[model samples]
Target: MAATAIPSYNPSPRVEPLVQYRPLHPTFGAEATADFATITPDLVDEIKRGLAKYGVLVFRKTGLDDARHVEMSHLFGDLDDVAPFVSGLGQKNRLSSDYLFDVGNVNPDGSVMQPGTMRDLLLKCNYHFHADSAFNPRRAGISLLLAHELPPAHLGGETEFADTRSAYEDLSPDRKEEIKDWVVLNSQLQCRRNANTDKDGILDPLLDTDEFDPMKHRFGKHRLIQLHDPSGRTNLYIAAHAHHVEGMPIEEGQRKLKELLDHAGQPQYTFKVQWKDPGDLVVWDNTCVLHRSVPGGYAGKYKRDLRRTTVHDMGPQAWGLNGVGATWRSGLD
Candidate 1:
């Protein structure tokens, strides 16, 4: 296979929105106000640009009916089915199985996926920091979560989003230069442990065997902190799946990673939306923005269901900032 020039250091680039978010519905009709497109009036070019730059965004109050959600999500990019690791609602609780991906305490059959004593530790994963599909090389670049249900008190269950693209920018040039070619490992299983912590462990959960181990069986993938090859735009691929620096010591790597993650999740680079009512759909670039839902203490309350769809990433975002890597034409259609 042909290869492009390898970047000696991770380069930095400015970030922008791939699409200019325009309202689908005008405040009023022609009689009252003016006619408008309800689905993103912005051009497809605008959306392509938006997704490349922002990594994720939301189409507010678009009124996606039962079939519309699947239709519209497909338009942005390709669609990816729910991962098998999540809970399936089975026959009785079919909503999650048919549409939404069941996360957290996904005991649809009332049979604990884990043990009874491990429930609290397990559910904490829903509150941890991570991105969708950080484990797969063909991870979803964008994930659209339409808010079908929300909490009654309506506060804690907010979806928290942090823009790593912006966070990476805030670092000094020296700092970025220092780790340009560096790659961070995204261990799929470890991430599952963080989000699916219902097992029996205090820190990052691990496989249960005779001699317990954290790094065993869980090798990592190196993802970049640079550009989205095709669009030639810069971004950050760090998330819950992100483990540590490739060559650094476990202790030092852990410390530096903690600092990066802490800065990335700070209020400044982060945004949270308290989803209320139906007809609200949100999409974000999972590669650039790490997101997690505060599933609320009301998961089984009034029954909130949100259907999510994904677009496959054209290339693994492993080369940071260098403007080097595959292109959408070579990756996304």
Candidate 2:
């Protein structure tokens, strides 16, 4: 009896978590506590799960270098290079890796970008709520943004995100049905125009330029309402990049788009993330959310060096209406 009892020995189970998440908002953003510098397969899987549930994940003080940033981004999906887009602007990528995009107001010489400059004006479009690479043939799925250097505290430069999935759920049944089958044409030029609409004479010089002509560029045609596969919820895909409805008059489509955007961007469905440390990282699913940069007094005074790596959407609707061989073009291409 004793020998038989001794034979059934069991050791205590040991369990360790790869990562943990703290909800930042009631519905959307989360703060992930983990060592992102040393990424593992299990860590990546957990990160993906967090993105699906929260739509945005903020990691503080990850201390990931440019190489590590690109490496970790690859675990999400194929990385999107900014070369094609920046080349058309007649600017060279200051970052060492093509996968790492410069999202801050810093010049190649490590100087602050003065206001009213071409780069500064172009970056103003980021103030509007929009999804990354929405105008590209294959839209962006995940974006990993790291703060390499930040401006002084309380000077602003915070990033804001809108929960489109939750916004869609808030819409009335009739409203949802009205846009259920609608398609929109998304263009980079349209995004710029929308951002500068109120600024008198700001876009005049660039309007007649071939590179800024909406008619000369190809547009990304995508459904206004789409099912976000990861979260298994429908989302409003409208953005500032959306030019007009597929079959409606330009004026009518613009009005409808503005209405939808205004409703979706209400304060109840938005969250703002402040950059506290230089190593702070924020990963967001562009497919289910829209993000914008907040303007602060730090512009032209301090350098905010933010770098981002974008992953191309690999889902069924990744290419939208653009078929295979539809490469990325900034009008010049």
lDDT of every model, 2 decimals: 0.55, 0.88
Segments in model 2 whose C-alpha atoms lie over 4 Å from true places: 1-10, 199-202
Tens-place lDDT digits, model 2, residues 73-139: 8988888997776676667888989898898999988899998877876788899999998888888
lDDT of 1 by residue, 216-293 (tens): 533335455667564565665676666677888877876787777888888777766656657666666676678776
Error of 2 at 102 (Å): 0.5
- Listed in order, each prediction's TM-score against the native is 0.68, 0.94
lDDT of candidate model 1 versus the reference: 0.55
Clashing pairs in 2: none
RMSD of 1: 14.3
Best by lDDT: 2
What's the distance in Å from true for residue 106, model 2? 0.3
Candidate 2 lDDT? 0.88
